[model samples]
Target: MAGNDVEAEKPAHSLFDNLQGLAFGVIMVSFGISLLKAQGLITGQAAGVAFLISYSGGIEFGLVFFVVNLPFYVLAALRIGWGFTLRSLACVASISVLTSLAPRLFSYAHVEPFSGAVVAGLCVGIGSIGLFRHGASGGGVGILAYYIQQRTGFRAGWLQLLLDAVIFTAAAFVLPGWGVLVSMVGALALNLLVAVNHRGDWYIAR
Candidate 1:
């Protein structure tokens, strides 16, 4: 029937709907990021680095996160398109605001460090997928890494690994040695979820 065909052709989400989805995704991510911060664990990218600085200097996580991501926008716009850049900006801003508001939201009385790391990983994993399906990226230095790979012949993964190494090294001073190791476990958890499910092959919303 013509009605059946018409219904099938409708977009799954309107533009406004997707924007809301993007905000929601970033909230979930910021919540997790804040939880991880409370535990003094690093996340292994721009966000992790922000957390590290926030811990050491007593600055707000939101400000550090927003500032660190500024440089990567140039790479994101050039390589990933303005839409992606804009969406990334939206994600960054939302997370920044949420990170600021998070402390007022609720303070954790007691959270086991390992448990907090695992929880942060799971939240970030799900949030990453939500952003992916909505056609946005959560901000990270990895954008610069991707741009470098495109221009030069280096792999983004290797570049990211190098950056992670530096982040963890700094984290060693901020957190206990075991906490640094658990941070790696959290990072692995986040990366594994993205690697396993974010292939375009697995998503067909377009």
Candidate 2:
């Protein structure tokens, strides 16, 4: 009991730790985004909105994603704190830049839709865990979800899942019917992973 308490009392992550963790999270998420782009698939949350706009408008995903997240910074700062808001901003910017560079860096020959969905889901989910553990996020809906979870005892993933349903529904009009279904699978996988693993009681870090 004493040892457990001591363990719980350990300090939050250092600057170096946060930098590496956030970088890892951003890279993983960017790779996942690239995979989704390769297959012409979409996921949920603000990223989904960016994908939809990018696909239809022929605008860049990074630009759209960054713009979509602008409003959320206010919410994040007011509710979550400046530290969290700043870290989230950095993570979001890094993802935007990396995802833009991803196409120039490498191209995929082919990726099966189902396989891509699962793999992309896993990558994003794991990466999100890293961000959450390090007191940051991919921004946009993530900031709202995390704030709600912290204030209301609601699980962030479940909240995100609910929001994802709305996003996927909108996706139906933008994408083919089958594509929307497959995207939902990816969203489900990602949200379920977060739901199970993102328990606040299990982690003491800020």
Best by lDDT: 2
What is the Cα-based lDDT of residue 47 in candidate 1?
Answer: 89
Model 1 agreement with the true structure over 1-206: per-residue lDDT tens digits: 99567657655868887877787789878988888877777787788888888888999889999998998888788777898788888888888998889888979999887778888987876786677668676667656654565467464445555677888888888988898898988877776665565554344454
TM-score of 2: 0.94
TM-score per candidate, chains pooled:
0.82, 0.94
Q: After superposition, how far is residue 112 of candidate 2 from its true place, in Å?
A: 1.5
At residue 194, what lDDT does model 1 achieve? 56
Q: Where does the lowest 10-residue lDDT sum fall in candidate 2?
A: 197-206
- Which residue pairs clash in candidate 2? none
**On residues 1-206, what C-alpha lDDT tens digit does candidate 2 reach at each position?**
99788777877888898888898999988988888887888999889999999988999999999999999999999988999999999999999999999989979887888888989988988888889889888959988988898899899899999999888888988999888888888888999999999887887665
How many residue pairs clash per model? Answer: 0, 0
